[model samples]
Target: MPKNSDITPLPASGPQNKPASAASVAMPADSHSEGGAPTSEIELPDFNDVELNNLISGVKLYLQEHNFTEFSESNLFLMLIHALRTAINTSNDLAVQNICKILINLNEIDHAGFMSLLSKKIDIAPYTGQSFAFTLVDQFYSATITRDTPSLISLNFLFSILLQSDSLFLKQLAELQASGNSEGMFGLLLIAQALLRSSTESLHIMSSELIASLVILILKKNEELINTRLFQPIPHAAFSGQSVLTFLLNVVKCEAQHSNEFNNLLLKQLIEAIHNAPESLVNEGLVRVIKRGPDEGLNAGHIFLQALIASVQIKNNKGVADLQVLLKTLSARAGFNAMLLDNITSGKYMNQSGMSMLVQALMAAKDNEYDLTPIMDVFAQIIAEQGKEKVLSALQQRVKYSSTTYLQLLTNVAKDDSSMTRLLNLLENESSHQETLNPAVNGFFSKTKSEKEAPEEEHKEFTSTHSSSASH
Candidate 1:
């Protein structure tokens, strides 16, 4: 391992000459045709170990002198990339580390340009570029495990670039899984765990992308891998008694407010996983996530509701069923109903689409005889908080298709004076009372009318009894 001093910046001023040995190396003569426009086919030159080392030395000097302006376009830059590739292929860790140090320093100079160049280079020969990237990522995992700060810093700089290109990063993991590279796949998981547990804010920021990618990848694998691997207990101290899935969800809960894309992506994968996996295993995992609650902001419960609403919108019946089961499983927990009610009542979880989905879920629960108490409670609160005008307007929009279900919900929740009054007013103001005259609505009015008359009848009986007693 190189000490910090060993990787220090070169002197501020230096002659910008290629090293003596580097002169022997072949450079692409021109990247443009006779028309003076850049050509699409620029050939990469090969270098032996000695020449590659000299080239790396020269590129290092060039970067120190020029500060990376046009560095990606320079022939020296091309040679540096080839050298790094060769070093990776040859398993030369020292050379790989040195090249990583250069790139890390380059990033400090111009982060955007550095990332742009990295992406282009990866796209040049994706498999080879991925090979190099995987090697660096594995090194990063090792450094993180051993607490090797210097190496971890350099490798994290490289790994962070890979994270920003999530598609490519995921492709690399897919390739590893296809090749039966269990070690490689496991290293990636460990890297995700480490990042999630990292205290450093920047590394922590990168954890969300890595975790989202890992989750998507794991969900795509076979059942054994999904259970034995993703659900296996994490060995880290920070993740005591938690599986990889739980730890990831915990981090996600804290980090979700920072990145909705991550939350949405993971939520989609989890919903799909629930739709596809054996009901018990996936539901168990989800129940555990919900049970732990959020370490901070948005939690798995919120995510579950979001996913459930989305599934309903898409008409993903299997996903909706699985999510509903998970919801029911958590409904009995302390304060679970209140949290859900608060979210829905505050409009945090219910848009027009969300409301329609909730209504649909409520209707299904009624048909299936599942307890609609929690959801009904949520609706009553939404009506109370948002008012009958807004809530009734929202329900009316969905009433055209399922007026029966909509009216049934109105009847079920019209258990109190204020709610019954609002329901009657809403029914009276309807443009057409035909649907409001349905059996359910008539039954609701009859039920309320009978209950109202019972109290008056009881009062008369009480007055007659009192008069009879006085006369006697």
Candidate 2:
């Protein structure tokens, strides 16, 4: 083994020559005394070597001594250079293990120079090369600015390195994902941040590949990390530059069925990113990243509707209105109204607790003054298209759609002082008018139960009639 010039008497790997504590070695080189070796006589490994364990403590001490100033950079780099070389020269299990231990221990320190050196030396095969590469990337990420500009630039070099190593990096990332190794996947995200940094135009040029890679990450790998706060900044970064945002928007607009949780989270984040995103991202080309699963088929339209509903629930008035318009565009483009009618009439979401969530969002959207007329128009159009039978079927499936609630809702609609008058008017139209709108309404009002002793069937019939009438 090579000597570490800066420090003499480095600790060696494997078992110690003597017991390091009062505990006896279970199997000794020779038969031991029945009781054990004398406690005082048992020698331990050198205290400093054993306590510091590896290069991590030394690197940390150096940073501490320098008050963590830029002047310490060169000295740290020198130490890391030697360590990287030593590990490379040894190139065996012990060396790899030692290097990993050191890197893990140094996780908290700002040691970009060391990370860069390690990244360069990590190309060696049969040594868990990808894990080491990602470790270096992770350290680089840790070194980045959490709240300032200068650090972002300093860390941008790491992005350059990641961009250069994309394929190898992605392959290793996939392996880590398959192995269910979250730490390794976290490192991959440090690399992914680079892709989000590309110019809007550049992203546009490579939108297909970018989206494909994002989908794979969200759907096929590292789900736990995909849902984390760390993943939140990516969409904003991806939309920072105009050219890239436009390109991304166009790509998303063109792709209709991105069905993955990661993509879902990304879509949610993209909606958030719109607040500060370049106009190109919000307006350029087509921008519906929220999509349906394969199982949804025609039923997939509800997914976007749910997303729209969620968007409207935002507390900010401007945001709610903006989203309402955005949703209108999306619904018109994707024909979501028909799907919603199908799900509601089929009672597909009747038992799903998220139905309540939808109601809550709708109530929230109701508070916004953005002429909900268009939204109501879409709702009416859907009913018109699906026929009253489907609409009534959907309402019957929803336990919340009782005759009492519809009556009260009608009363409230008649009393509202807001801009939802048109929707309210539609709902208050007479039973006969509703019949012209949908056959379900016609069938519904045709039956009547006794005043005080209405049969269960009669109650359902009465409720359906009121619900249909309320929508007229």
Best by TM-score: 2
Predicted candidate 1 versus true structure: per-residue lDDT over 1-472, tens digit per residue: 1011011112122213446332333233433333121222544445566655666787666665554543544445444555665665555556767888787777668665554444331212322223333444555554444444445445555655544543444344333322223323434455555555542233443444544554555465544444444544444434433555654544443443343465555555554554565545553444332222222222344444444433433322344444455555445333333343232232222322334445555544443344456565565555555544444445543232222334344445344435344544554454244353433333334455545343443333332332121110
Cα lDDT tens digits for candidate 2, 1-472 = 1111111112223224443321111112222222221122222232233332344345444444443223222223323423443333333223334444444444325344333333322222222223345544443333221221232333333333433432444343333311222323434454344333332123332332443354334323323333232222223222222222222222222222233233334444444444333333333322222222221121223333444444443344333444355455544532344445333322334332222223333444555333456566555665566554444444433334443323223224323444444543444344456645444434333343232123334334543342221110
**Candidate 2: worst-modelled 10 consecutive residues by lDDT:** 1-10
- Pairs with backbone N, CA or C atoms under 3 Å apart (clashes), candidate 2: 200-243, 200-244, 201-243, 201-244, 344-394, 345-394, 426-472, 427-470
lDDT of each: 0.44, 0.35
327, model 2: CA deviation in Å?
2.2
- Model 2 residue 211 CA deviation (Å) reads 19
Query: How many residue pairs in model 1 have overlapping backbones?
Result: 0
Off by over 4 Å in 1: 1-21, 24-28, 33-39, 43-58, 61-73, 76-100, 107-206, 209-353, 360-410, 413-472
Give me the displacement of residue 68 in model 2, in angstroms.
25
Clashes of 2: 8
In candidate 1, the residue pairs with backbone N, CA or C atoms under 3 Å apart (3 or more residues apart, or in different chains) clash, namely: none
**Cα RMSD of predicted structure 1:** 19.5
Question: On a 0 to 1 TM-score scale, where does candidate 1 land against the true structure?
Answer: 0.33
Model 2, residue 12: C-alpha shift (Å): 8.2
